[model samples]
Target: MTAVTDQDHTDQAGDAGSENREGPVEEPVGGDADRGGKDGHTRVESAKGGPARAEAGPGRARAEAGPARGETVENAEGQADADSAGGWDDGLIARRVTAETEQAAAVEVRGPNAPPAAPLAYDAPLHSRLDALRELVGLSRARLDSRTLAEAGQVLDEAAARRRLSGQHTVVAIAGATGSGKSQLFNALAGVAISETGVRRPTTAAPIACSWSDGSASLIERLGIPPRLRRRPLQSAESEAQLRGLVLVDLPDHDSAAVQHREHVDRILALVDAVIWVVDPEKYADAMLHERYLRPMAGHAEVMFVVLNQIDRLPGEAAEQVLDDLRRLLDEDGIALGEYGESGATVLALSALTGDGIGELREALGQFVAERGAPARRIAADVDAAAWRLRPVYATGRRTGLSEEARDDFAARLADAVGATAAGEAAERAWLRNANRACGTPWLRLWRWYQDRREPPTGRLPLRAHPEEEATARQRVEQAVRTLADRASAGLPAPWAQAVREAAVRGSQGLPEALDELTARAGLPPGRPPRPGWWPAAVLAQASMTLLQIVGGLWLVGQIVGVMAPNLGVPVLLMVAGIIGGPLVEWSCRMAARGPARRYGVEAERRLREAASGCGRARVLDPVAAELLRYREVREQYSRVVGV
Candidate 1:
């Protein structure tokens, strides 16, 4: 382990000189090393993106890759040792961060000379927040924009890697523009010349890590810092003891002319737990600093420390004026400022050159590190920022999925499309036609039958669209589907609304044909139209009248032939009575059949209407409702992620 002493200025300068002579020997892991990690662990790879051998310690050999899947390693005690090479499993940090008091009863074995481990603060709420985000993405990935869902997943993955590496250590980066004295402040905090400071523009090209305690290798490695660039502060001062879990980083100038340097700064800033933004009097209000970084990261005020470096350069009263102006600028950038123990950004003035106000800054940092909550707070702020960005996509005022009025209107439209009304009217007319045939005058019936032999009277009653209506039936059905979709998606967010419409369209693929088939099946009856109970009596009466007419005609014929004499014109009277009675009986039967025929037609209309309405509800309306329901469920999951 590399350690510095309070009385080792010469050795510190010598160490810095050796690092410069070796050129930039610290190579970042992987090509895009600053992308954080995947699966809750940092991606440790060689410079060429391949696995490389690593030195774990003086006597122990380490492999970049772990054991093969399902392979186990045993320690000297013949016990299973899963953390032999990687030191700990990926889930170890997660379990430690989220474990409750009840689980603390389990015992852990330690080496004879190993010191007792620090107690971990339980942050189950933060873990729960990450879980909520994961669930939300899983449920809404298809319904939402792919970019939004990807961003949410990135947040979860970043959180997992960070917490797994070191939940107790708070990684704080000192960042600023060129010639902003940030490197000077970093060295002063370390009490050694760890980061080189000079007048050259963008003196720091990459981040340097100075951890106050041991056991920070995993965290430093996760930050993409090479082993050679890692340093240790003097472990002799009581003031330094309070900062045991602090990992201070010196970042390159954010506004550097070199694109690669600026990229490095941005990537490192994204993964750090907190930031101590160092600004000077000359460039304290630079537009690049505020517009590019501070304004965009306003939600992270809880983990920000805005320090005005080089206060010694400003005149006595000018320093105060400049500090006040900086505060105003930060406020305009939407960063809340806190005084000492509040929940906002800490704004203060210090001079690394004169060591003025450095004591106050150290005290504040010590208190912050002692709390052991910076990791959780930074993760929470990240979640807040992501949730706010997605607010417009998932928010809505509508609680109900489908309205009753809209459903009824869709059913009515389907009934009309199936021609329910016209079918009922046709059935009523068919009943009348059949009744007329059964009870009309006998001579008229015979004439109709004779006429029917030449040209048959066609009487087939079935519910179906007219020849002209076939073309527009599908169009009417599609309109009903669109109407239901619109009703279900009202006031919904854009993504979910589109989803509902899509579901409606998908369910409507074969609906028109199905509805046509339904009506066809409902239209067929077993036999001819049902006959009323009084039909037989009417037939008998008609037969009797016909007999009388025949008798009268024969008597008249006999009288005219002089074979027998007629009595008091009885033959003529009988013929007249038979003709009038036959017509009267037909009229009475027609009137009686009207009421029953009308009822049957109405009943047929009701049944067909119900059948058409049911078909529509099953195909179109149900899918739309399901989409709405899925949106509601995902929205609630998003709310839980936001902790609302």
Candidate 2:
């Protein structure tokens, strides 16, 4: 039989040693149960009470006695040992168990430590962190919505990119009256023969842009220049370097007799960021330019250059004084200049032909471009000016909501003024009475029975009776609307007032036609039929009744004569009663006709009210509705800007 190593013995003890005794055992090192000897090896005894077996190497040997039941031993190499010594060696077994405990303690202290197990499940802490970040993002989005900051963000982004791309470009537009020499200054500044400088007033029809090679082509494109008028790139080195990124514009004359040229100047002035207002000695103080353009552009304080051109014509000292006067005028017009302790405008003197201050002007322009970076703020000012001009068009106040009680009161007052309720009830009653009259005797008798069954009138009816010829209620309503419109427009300027008046006139133009249509639709009596003289109808009816009464009276007298001795006084009394009663009955019928006539008057008043309400809705309320729509659009744009 092959000898079992100490490692084999420990392995056999762990796996029940019967197979180990039958064959050579291949036990794992440091896997021992009974290696309690000093060399860290253990010995095991055979089951037949043989000597304790000494295992080779540094491991315990397996015993043939199958680990001696409960006896346990250990090796010094920090492994569990299983072994047996017969004859009740309890103390020895206890010592062996203590040795195994010490070995395990040593192994725990010295062995390679296992890394912490990889997180087998999702990390709750990491998920919580992500949730916190998501909440922060949501809050930021909500803040943006509340303030309309998103639009500001977009504008800032566009402006920043534009600034990054725009270099030393200084865009200067020449704006002036018809004979202001704006084109001459533009050509002088450009140092080239680019624009059409002429002697005729309002020479420049369209805006012309001249730029040095170093200037921005994209900016010129953004100005919406057509190909033919676009100037060729300047190639002179000194001109190119000094005027690098300089965009000089010769704009159309603003005070031209031709409306198209004036409009062109106005449009380009509104779009360009910087304006060099070119004024000559003659028309420098023109009130038309001051009122039409300069006053309206009061908000465009930035990037404004007021140039007194054609100074060559004036005496040298007089030119300085003229510039000072012009600056004072600009101040009075509310254009604040930085040189005068304000933040924005500038005034300069220049002679385009003499080129007296051209170098200084160019140097100042370059400095402006360098210091200000770009004209973004000026462009924003232009936009604001345009928006300001449009504000009056949308300055309507909201319609106040009336209380329910007020509405009811207004309706009642209007109804009473136009007699609507009385008219409606009267129309129904009149139709009923007319039907009764048109019916023959049986229906008339029925109507009388119905009326007799009801209660009698306590006094006059609740509403006053309408007159035979009703008042002009439709005309009154139209006049009221007109008066209200006039009051609403009383404080407006002439142009605005005129616009309101035109709108009102247009709105009411169709009123007469509408009233005619309403009258036709209502089926009211178009006009009154001519009545015969009252005496004629009265005489006819009375004569017929009298004839009947006389015939009856004569018959009755004859009957009485046959029956008994007839008295002559009875015949006379019967004839007199017949004649008098006939006229009385005729008078009673005529009195009864008054009620039907009053009902017709009521219906005429109702027709008038209906026409008034229709006109009010179409002319007054409809125009107000359209104006409100325009106001809403302006409000939306304003809100977008102010972050409301």
Candidate 3:
């Protein structure tokens, strides 16, 4: 066998440019050596000036070979051996190898200098993305409160089992007024003497839970009852099988002499998934139970059973009439039954002593459990209703939902009502006048020149209007605001409307006091004194003389001085007696007027803001609180259904 030599060659000179231009160079095959000259391969003679080195056959020596040529061949062979040992010397080879390995391995490259290949981009459907966002929002909402999340989880679990029938159960409660034989009825239902029946009006002071089988021990535990407090199961296979998941409760009389017994009855009724209202024929139409319990519980239409216990005492036709009247009363309370024949609310005639209709009642309860499959669906419906009720509470609308035109109109009307327009104009004129008075001679001259360039008022100036006159204007503005608020709250519910009204009253009552306080705090001057009626006659005489001065100068001036001197001198002397009178008067008036005006404006704005806030509280926050309560009730019902 022949051993094959693996030879590699690397050219150092001119290699950089060649590698840059042509990339990696391909090694020539063994058969192409003789045709290299024809294929443009270059050759050089040795320095000893002999013929170029020629290839010899294997194990053969070349004749007439110079020492330099021999040495050159040996040098070339040594270099070739060194190059073969090193493999490729180009940095590009390393980079290319790295790139190829990365590409083969399917790793992504992101840099601009990285290899040109399309990048991976994820594109999801709109609905799927929206669903993900909805799920995230739902999770965040669920985690807002630990109690709320726990309740919701319980409700969801119960809802998942809504359609199943095997694990279904009923919660028939023996409830009645005092001395109505509820305990005896409970004993009759259980087919055993579990409940203590006595001659007293309220024999059962506390509730007793009696199951047909011991399988309800866990359920009894969930009711927070100890083994000592619970009753033993009866020994009957048929009864046990029929009452597999049933939880028959014997409650204390609702109209007991002891208030605690009545409270216990009320509490247990709320917690139970279903109710068996055991009423005597005489007290079947009792107003206390009908109004307080039955009417309020109209929402629980699905899980209610009305039983006319002790039916043997009533006359044959009277019992039917009493049941009919009871049904009518329930219908008026918004408790809708499916029909007279097949209704959610079943009115049964039973005598605990005679055992009449006891088996039929048991069969009815069993059938109901088998068909309705437990209170899971009803509990889910309750939760769904609660969720729907809560939906409006957290509802938000776009701030710009109200039209721009409507908003602008409202703002304009509000400004007009609050005297904002008149106040702004008055402020501008007052500011200008005060500023002109405060300015030096140069600025005063410039102001006068500017004023002269503009047209003078053709009507009365606003400052000449009476102080009381502005109050009337302000009153008009306040009235408008009140009207607007009233109108805005018109469509709200009764409680919210009342809240808006209450808030408005509070705002109105507070506005004036706030304004007065602001006025008292301001450091401003007093207002002008009241003028006498004779001042008009005096002003007429002075004006007539002043006009004469312009017509007849010297003589008119002397006469005017003589008449005006005494009164004018007296006032001027009093004012100029080491008193800075002008500034004090101006300061007093500004202090009195500006403070109240600013406060009134601020208060009005505050009232409007408060009114808006109150509206939001009534229409949004309060509703949310109510909805949360409703949700809590639904959650409790769901927990009961799921046996949590």
What are the lDDT figures for the candidates, one per model? 0.71, 0.51, 0.46
* Per-residue alpha-carbon lDDT of candidate 3 for residues 133-239, written as tens digits (9 for 90 to 100): 23323543522345434444444443333222223445557788876777778766765444556665567766777554323444444444433234433335676
lDDT for 160 in candidate 1 is 74
- For candidate 2, report its TM-score: 0.39
| Model 3 regions more than 4 Å off | 1-169, 213-224, 314-318, 332-334, 338-343, 371-408, 414-477, 498-644
Model 3: lowest-lDDT 10 consecutive positions = 100-109
The number of clashing residue pairs in each candidate reads 0, 11, 8
Q: Using TM-score, give the best candidate's number.
A: 1
Candidate 2, residues 104-203, lDDT tens digits: the string is 1000000112122111121343233223323322333421242433333433433343444444465668888877888777756754434555565556
Error of 1 at 87 (Å): 36
Q: Where in model 2 is the C-alpha error above 4 Å?
A: 1-170, 175-188, 191-208, 213-244, 251-271, 280-301, 309-316, 332-334, 351-356, 370-393, 396-408, 414-644
* Superposition error at 70 for model 3 (Å): 99
Give the per-residue lDDT of model 1 (tens digit) for 1-644.
11111112122223223212222122211112111123111112222212333222242222233222212111110122332333333221111111111110000111123232343343777778788888888988778768877768878888877756766678899999999999889867866445767676767776778777544556777778864455555334563577778989898889999897788788888888899999999999899899999999998998999999999988879999999999999999999888655689999999998889888899889988888788788889888888888888888866657878899899888888888888787777778767877888888788877876896343435444376687687788889999888889888988889999999999899988899888877763655688899999998888888877888888888898887786638988888878888988889989998998898788778877888988887888888888888888888888888997
lDDT: the better of candidates 2 and 3: 2
Deviation of model 3 at 638, angstroms: 20
Better of 1 and 3 by lDDT: 1
